[model samples]
Target: MTQAENERRGNVPPSNKRYFYRTYGLTIASQLELPELPKAEATSQPDVVVLTPGVAEKLEGATFRKGWLEMGDDRCQITIEGVARYRVEDGQRILLDRRVPREVDPVADPGDIRLFLLGSALGGLLHQRHWLPLHVSALKTPSGVWAFTGHSGAGKSTIGAWLHYTQNWPLVTDDVAVIKPHEDIPYLHPGPPRVKLWKDALAALGIQTEGLVRDLTREDKYHLMLNKGFQDHPSPLKALVMLERAEEGEAASLERIRGVEAFKSVMATLYRPEMGTEFNTAEQLMRESIKLAGKIRVYRFRRPWSLDQMNSSIEPLLHEIKQ
Candidate 1:
């Protein structure tokens, strides 16, 4: 490792406890501590490192916009309005600058900014590292790991929660699924042990709201801790389910997706599409997409918006996965 990497691996001038954590197939070291994630094993080496609190006020080449600006194909600069600014570099290093707002609550914890970093910034990092991050929730079942992908409000998290709480399928990830493609099979990495749920979705499933942490980013949304926790090891991906909301009277059903259509549909679910653009990963993404589509079973899963239909779709979905 280089001197810079050595500094990142706990040789930097210190202020707080440097915490080690694992996620998305990498062991990470971060100074901005988070209590929500499990600590990494002592003997494991870090793949990425996050430096905190002193990231540059503005990146030299950045063209600041509403929230972020593209810094060429290898880097990007993003700000969280009044919270923080981040400079993500080459998929390996992240620099964060935390800010305090004048109107902020005196007791409000500013750590949420770090959470945003882990999500958006990390997504960018994965792209730079040649990993394909998808906007999907995943879980392990007897059949293997199944990925649920869709546009926002298509019930990815709700279904993941349902699979976890009701069907007893252990949660693998929520929101972003980072995949490492092998010869013909891509492996799914476990993410942070948190599930975000809308108030109505939680209520529909009879899950209690008490003591849950509110997601400040989205109104009336709560972050839930999984009872069974996350799978630390990677699991081979078995299937992809593209979720779509059907008309009120339309019954839930699953249909196979094949050939070029499957590739296009799957590509649309990339966690942050522009991240790929930044890395000039289109060619690589195309190759990976075709391989993934050809290897895994892809299905278009349509269901009503109503939660009652969820249970009815579960068994059929499992059966489809088995096939």
Candidate 2:
């Protein structure tokens, strides 16, 4: 898409008529034509439709719990009801006149709000190693596409934020990268083009907070939008790094981990949960991801998240990989 075209269609806001909430991946589409988006906080339902290019994945054993809301993006609609979130496949016309949310205290603070939504998220961040979706964080540098992998709090956002801060690199995608494997050179579907890091971490990265969006999740958690006032670019992936955290001095160095061990690392960093995306999707994603790993170098990176450890341990690894 041309810059002029993207400039014409700015970001849409949330609507009171509808809400959007989900854990599945989506493909931003072009056929969507909406009059206007509702002006409200980033709540559950938005009256307007979002455009995505990726295919909508369904969830298994989904149930409508209290405090859940349904969010739709053209090809996908996620009803985040109760503890289990459901991915509704058919995107037929929604009856907005019948739209009714259970109830939520809009004036509540982040922590209290989080309490209300926990059942909706249903311990999303606590999934087992084999269940999480294999999400990718990547950038489009002049040299090649750089992709990073990790579980929640595995520091994918932290590291991706740091790279964007210090180096001024253009990001390809973050949080999710829909893969189309086996094309000789594996490529990631153009994703959200940004990853929101914690504000304190952003400050520590030495990048001034210019136009970042502050998304407050419940409790002590907050995410900062990195694409604030930035542009998007499409690029092919070059290197894939699977991350794992350890004690300050645990990892002696970033070694070339290979064979099943390498595949295991890739599996460990997935982002989607088990209920929404099944084992078959996991196997397919892994097959494509492993192919990418086979073509390019896949490194298992272990590092402490502290400032000292980040620089002393992980910095060297980045330097080594870039070479």
TM-score of each: 0.88, 0.60
Candidate closest to the true structure, highest TM-score: 1
- The residue pairs found clashing in candidate 1 are none
Give model 2's TM-score versus the native structure: 0.60
RMSD in angstroms between candidate 2 and the native structure over all alpha carbons: 10.3
For model 1, the run of ten residues with the poorest summed lDDT: 99-108
Tens-digit per-residue lDDT, 1-323, candidate 2: 54323322222322323334322222211122221111224443432233322312342333322233323222222343221122223332221111113255312232322322222222232121122334667766556777787666777777776676667776666666544443455555443334557666766776555654345452333444343422343445666787778775575356677777766766665554443333234566567547655766678777876755565666656677467
Local distance difference test, candidate 1: 0.76
Candidate 1 per-residue lDDT over residues 145-178, each given as its tens digit:
9999888888899988888877777888887877
**lDDT by candidate, in order shown:** 0.76, 0.46
Task: Assess the local accuracy of residue 294 in candidate 2 as a C-alpha lDDT between 0 and 100.
Answer: 73
| Candidate 2 Cα errors over 4 Å, as ranges | 1-77, 81-87, 90-98, 105-134, 141-143, 206-218, 226-233, 250-252, 273-286
